[model samples]
Target chain A: MKGQRFLGLGYLGPYIIGLLVFTAIPFFGSLYLSFTKYDLMSSPDWTGLANYERLFTRDRTFFKSLNVTLLYVLLTVPLKLAFALFIATVLNYRLQFIGLFRTAFYVPSILGGSIAIAVLWRYMFATEGLVNMALATIGLGPIDWFGDPTNALLTITLLRCWQFGSAMVIFLAALQSIDKSLYEAAAIDGAGKVRIFFFITLPLLTPVIFFNLIMQMVQAFQEFNGPYIITQGGPLKATYLLPLYIYEEAFKKFNMGYASAIAWVLFTIITVLTLIAFWSSKKWVYYAGDKRS
Target chain B: MTDITTSNDLTMDETARAKRRAGLRLFSTAIRYALLFLVGFVMLYPLIWLVGASFKTNSEIFSGAGFLPQNPTLDGYIKGWQTSTPYTFGRFFWNSFLIILPKVIGTAISCTMAAYAFARFDFPLKKVLFGSVIAILLLPNVVTRIPQYILFRDLGWLDSFLPLWVPSALAGDAFFVFMLVQFLRSLPSDMEEAARVDGANSLQTLVYIVVPMLAPALISVCLFQFMWTMNDFLGPLIYLSSVDKYPVSLALKLSIDTTEAFEWNRILAMSVLAISPALIVFFAAQRYFIEGISSGGIKG
Candidate 1:
């Protein structure tokens, strides 16, 4: 019995070590570091609340990045979810060659958030690039995609939206798992297609929607690659997201203390947002077989 | 004669209704295919363009927006393979595989072991530990990057793959562990109980019974690790500094940075090569890929 107990612990040993070294210690370490002034070369000096103070009081870029990130999350998450849901609905049909379309949509996601894709995006949205070329043929736009500050953020947002396949696949799975009999019953009652979808499908899908929303929101806040490679947070810091700001502060400027403070702020925002999502989900997210509140 | 005319009129009404219904069905089908094609085109255009651009000369790439190269050439592939870096693209590919293979195997082993413990055993602190796993999954990795960097730097493990894959060996990915735990929960504990009754130890039972039953989930874990590691940028960017040690992702970035004229064709070709392994792996085991995603590996 003692040996069995030890064996269980043995199995968990690696994970325990990882938690300590990678997660727990660093988590607290960063929290502590957020309160101190330290560059990589020097030992950290205690400066209680100074980093936080500086961030709140004097950091214009900090607030700008925060606003930009918030705007990004606002724009990308809903749009991506809608796009995913729409595609997944189309895919939910028992159509021939559906796998090909699913794979096609998913291919970009499989190459998700890579430097290569970001680079490809940069060129694609360039002034004389493919997007503009297509626009010209349509007699519509040679719009400056990454040039104008107004449009630069949108460019990056579109890139995030483009990789909606992961969320779509999750939604597809959820849609597939939904009780088909419910749909049959609705149809038998003479419920129109849209009515059944809005009343039945949408309600049942709220749980997955909630999940995707939270995940995508968190991802959008920490988004780096598209802004980093495609826009370089350029055209007047339009896409200077919080994560990039933290990276620049920590590594580029070697202000680890301030960077840690920024990171903690981000951490807090994510946690709060996630909590808010969970709290709000109680109203709409329906889990089958669970008692209604 | 009047009664026969009335019957003909009723038949005409029935035919009209049927024709309208058919038209609606055809219209809906057309709309569905149209939407699928439009979205698929948007999803795939960049990749298709990348391949086409790979064969075009720098000047040719600028001349037209069309995917077809006016003058198709192998110069991009030939030149991109010989990057200006001391190491070639082939070296970077090897480096990627080196990181990917070990990370995948390590993740499978460590995650399965930890998940098995969480699933089958009644251990102390299990609840807290499992909760921590979920919490960690929610925690953005960017928050941990600086402190991890400092820690690894202090340990003199900078500029190495150790900082990258060693953590996987320790089941650092809480997502995979959680996923496997979920998988294990869905499985009946009968085989494991049988093995225990037959005097098998925990490890032996895991190897003999649990592992074989857990093959699909385990394969999903491995596939995800493979694809994610291959496409990972930030990890390699943070940990590695040496050009020789650079993986395909970093190496591709390095080529862009170092090249003065910025040969789009060559860079695109190298980009194609950089992503080929992941694309090939995904296409080959797409079942596992989709299974992994649907089974709760939510992040792309």
Candidate 2:
């Protein structure tokens, strides 16, 4: 028995070392660095809460990034989930060439956030690009996608939303698992399609919906590549997301301490939001095998 | 006489109801197909445009509104392959494979081993360890970037592929660990027990019995790691400073940054090339990929 236990430890040895060295150490190191003033050259000098204070009180870009990030989460999460659920529900039916459609819908997600896609996005939205040419046909002027502050964030949001395949796949899986008899019962009761959906499908799907919501929210909060590659958080910093801000503060300006503080703040926001979602799930999320309260 | 009249009226009502049902079914089917087509087009239009633009001339790219190029050219592919750097795009692709291959193998080995322990053993602190794996899965990579960068710099591991694949060997991706743990738990332990009763050791049982059963899950892990490492931008961007060590992701970005007159054709061509491997891999192993994603979500 003891030998077996020792062997188990041996099996787990690599992960244990990895967690301690990479995850645990860096995690604590960042927290410690958050309280100090350090560039890459010198040792960290303790300046307790100064980084946080400055971030809250004086840092305009910090607040700008925060607001931008919040708006992005608010806009993108719901839209992405709605898009996913809608497509999943549509594709859930028995139809010919359904696999092809699912694959097509998912391909964007697979290639998403690549420099290639970002570069393509930049071109497609450029002044004389395909988007503008399409707009011309519709009798509208060419809108400045990357230049104007108002439109820059929207352009990036669209890019993020375009990668809705992962969420859709999850929803599709959930939808398939749903008992078909419930739909039949609802239909037999003379319920309309919308009514049946709201009462039967939507209610049953709450758990998966909650799961997708939390995942997408966390992902959106940490989104980097879209805005970084396409807009570079430009046009008056309209699209300056938290990750972009943190990257610039740490790597670009070499303000490791300040960047660590911003990172902690971002971490807190994600944790709190996730907790709230979990807390809220108790009321609405329905687990199939669990007894109803 | 009254009974006969009532029966006849009921038959008439049934015919009308069936006709209405057939009409509604046709209407709904049309709507479903229309919506699917629209959404699919929206999802795939950008990629279609990308491939189309890659073959177009610089002038044609700006002027062309449609997906098809007026006059297709291979100059973009020819020049884009030989970048401004000393090495060609082939070198960058090779660099990507260098990182991806080892990382995939490392992830598979480490994650499976750890998952096997977690699933099979009743070791002390097992619950705590498993809980921590879940906790780590939620911890965003952004929070650890600065500290990790400093650590790697101190170790003099920067500007090399060591930082990319070494941690993977150590089971750094908690998600993969958690996934394999779930998969292992779902498998029957009867075979393992029988092997043990036959005096086969745990390691031997795992090698002979459990691993063969875990092949699909392991392949899923490998495919995922391959796709992610191939598409990874930030890790390579942060660790590798030299253009020579650059993966395709970094190489593609470098071209964009250094080019004075952004040749749309060449950039788009390289972009297509950069994305092609992922797309091809995805289409080929799409079943395993979807199974991994969907199962990982539900089980997690």
**Predictions' DockQ, in order:** 0.64, 0.77
Interface RMSD of each: 2.0, 1.1
When summed lDDT is taken over every stretch of 10 residues in candidate 1 chain A, the lowest stretch is: A284-293
Report the interface RMSD that candidate 2 achieves against the true structure, in angstroms. Answer: 1.1
| TM-score of every model versus the real structure | 0.95, 0.97
Candidate 1: lDDT of B5? 96
True contacts kept of 1: 0.66
Which tens-of-lDDT digit does each residue in B53-130 have in candidate 1? 999988888667788898899999999899998788989999999998888888999999999999888777888998
Q: CA lDDT of each candidate? A: 0.88, 0.90
Give the residue spans of candidate 2 off by over 4 A.
Answer: A291-293, B1-8
